[model samples]
Target: MPAPVRTAAQWAQFGRDHVSHGLGRMQDLVVVKGEGLDIYTSDGQKLLDFTAGIGVTNLGHCHPAVTAAVQNQVGSLVHMQCSIMFHAPYLQLIERLLPVMPHPSLDQFFFWNSGSEAIEAALKLARKATGRPNVVVFQGAYHGRTYGSGALTRSKPIYTQSTGPLMPGVYTTAYPYWHSLGVPPSTSEEEIVRLAKHQLDMLFRQQVATKDVAAIFIEPVQGEGGYVPCPAPFMNHLRELCDKHGVLLVIDEVQTGFFRTGSYFSVNHIKGFRPDIMIYAKGIANGFPLSGIVSNKEIMATLDVGSLGGTYAGNAVACAAGVAVQDVFASEDIGGNVNARAEQLYNALYALRDSPKTAPLVAQVRGQGLMAAIEFRMPNDPLTHEGLDKGTHIPSNIGKRVQEFCLSKGLVVLTTSCFDTIRFIPALVVSEEQMDKAMKIFTEAVQNVANEG
Candidate 1:
């Protein structure tokens, strides 16, 4: 017998009753289907999905090629435990990934279930390969939420609040976020990089010594940390520092991989840049539960044979989807689309920043490729002009207000970091027309919020 159909409100109520309260939701709308650049609500309203399932749907929801690959794989094999045997999809996915990797030196791969698990695996590999006990991370970094990755996440205290005694042997240094450092937006990138380097030096001298540090984990563009891209000079400096101290450099590409940043990987933006280990997940398989770390054969070989296998790590279906994702990347000009859409997004955001009504609230606009953000500062905030009343009182949660406004008008966006910053993570395949529409909705939302303030 068929179950009774429930209205969207009923479904939402049921979810609120049964789902864990800790799992936050941006909206109560019951999403029934997603295609291309839009999500369909249970009540039949369509919304422009600017969040892209939090950067996991880079190729867009249920891309036809990926969908076909997954369907075929599911019919053949769903879950082939990695420890039991090798699978065709797993091997094929690696074959597809090799040529597109940021560097040829990252020749080895280990599949995992999530970005957090991949991060854990990378940390273990780094510790084993280097025989070091400590790991270094930057301030405002968001690797993941699992214990090991949580220990390294410094973007917000709420992530670690009440979670006690996180994985030990983790130290933090400053990332080149001038806003977090209370510096003006005009602060030179070189100065910020210099300050960050000096802090890392201090961490080595005062906290963990270079010899004991196993790896330094970083995001090419900090995702949960206000969409701030690490300066190329700082990235090169980290590479140099890692070389000087034998510290493995782990680039967390969870949110920035798979052409999200107008390249195969965000690290590609830096000249002659290569990471000791690259952690990938998010959009690797569109929306599938797949992630992995790629390192050199030497580093991977340091771990024992039985050290890294997970029961469902390299699920055949997920691997099939991953292979298909790479196939799409090879055949399509997704990277080109990302760059074009990113330019459109930035132009719109910069226009908002320059507008008289929104200028006071627009603290900063920063990002790379389509991974963009607009941070809001209250009128009296130090980041903006103090004592400048813009006719109305600006709320502290202005980002949330803007998000709500967008959602109410059939757009879905997300907030990031500890600041009042809204992130924009549209699918890489979003068309020019779709981007214009999204920008139109987003511009109206910001303008409305600014007016309300």
Candidate 2:
């Protein structure tokens, strides 16, 4: 969103009066239009976008091919009872997605309207297939907001406040925070690996039987819970554990798929790992409402006919958009572009890490490909060691402030996890020229905010 002369406050007030108060607004910016990786505010200010509409819009806002596909599909058949009746556009997109999937065994897909719905469907499918009610997830993981997905998201208290008496038999355990947990993330890969397996073991021993656990839900690179890349060895071990336990491993790839992580999925990047079920959305349709839960034939077939369907499931326009986006990745160096932009973005963040601007608050820079996070540290107070690393207070504030600084300077970032961190999920099409421009503006904002301190 561009900054108008009247700025965010003026438009914000108008919106508070006119617009519905239900949708959550971030940073108080009013974006009116977008092109490529840049968004223009109602005030006519242009900011380099790092957050691609919360990981949507990976092909960037309104790519011409996707736009044309959507327009063409809308003209043909915009909506259909895809389950009861067949639609060519839907079938075509599904066919396109099959080969790109991690497992050909998981060729069967159930398209939904959003990530949450896809997750909910996966949960239900797993439970039905296994004849089990219990499921497991990590402490810092996020799935989505539907009842089942919400039950597994253990990151934020606010999401659960007064809401939970959520689905029963959903269990959780300490996810590996190897570096912070005295396990040297690199040198103690052995220990880290042991801890992840142990945590799941503890969950099973205390909460649910190994056989009773239907699925182990995970995000390869956790999005809302901070962009924490699940360790490779740990992930491989998890695959083994699931096999031994006869538990399905369901991965939520809503945020990391579609070249966002330099591959179709983080799972594909990690060797010896494949989920029995995987949820994908966000960039799947280039900002359109289309998501899916794809699972192995054995698991997906457990659902009786007509058990799941949606008014907009396999929506023609969205599916066409998805197919076009897939074409872009298949033809262009979109994956390489994401990886290249990721390096540029990471390098920019690191260059600022030691700068007086970001250093005082900087904790760590972590990510894979274009999905990255900047975690802020609790400012150590010598007068009171008690304040250092205090429970979720200091970091969250710093994160918010950093978001404000970025927003003020025409850069968009998102707050995530239980930390003081901002996520960077720019479009896979972000250019080197635009990145250079963004870096300079971002540095200026951080420096200005630092000087204020």
Tell me each candidate's TM-score.
0.97, 0.91
| Candidate 2 global Cα RMSD | 4.2
Candidate lDDT (C-alpha), each: 0.90, 0.80
Model 2: per-residue Cα lDDT over 1-453, one tens digit each: 885565567888878888876566785668888888888887678888877888899988879999999899888887887867888878888888988888667788888889889988988898999999889888788887767788888888666668768898888876666532444323355676677778777777777888888988988888877798888887787788899989998888999998889988889897646789999999999989999998877787789988888888888888888889888888898888887888998998898776754665566778999899877664442221222343423322667776777777777877888766778888889899878877787777666656666
lDDT of 1: 0.90
RMSD of each: 1.7, 4.2
Worst lDDT run of 10 residues, candidate 1, spans: 383-392
Which residue ranges in model 2 land beyond 4 Å of their true spot?
1-11, 18-22, 178-189, 355-358, 380-396
lDDT of 1 by residue, 271-303 (tens): 779899999998999999999999999899999
Please tell me which predicted candidate would have the highest lDDT against the true structure. 1
Number of colliding residue pairs in model 1: 0
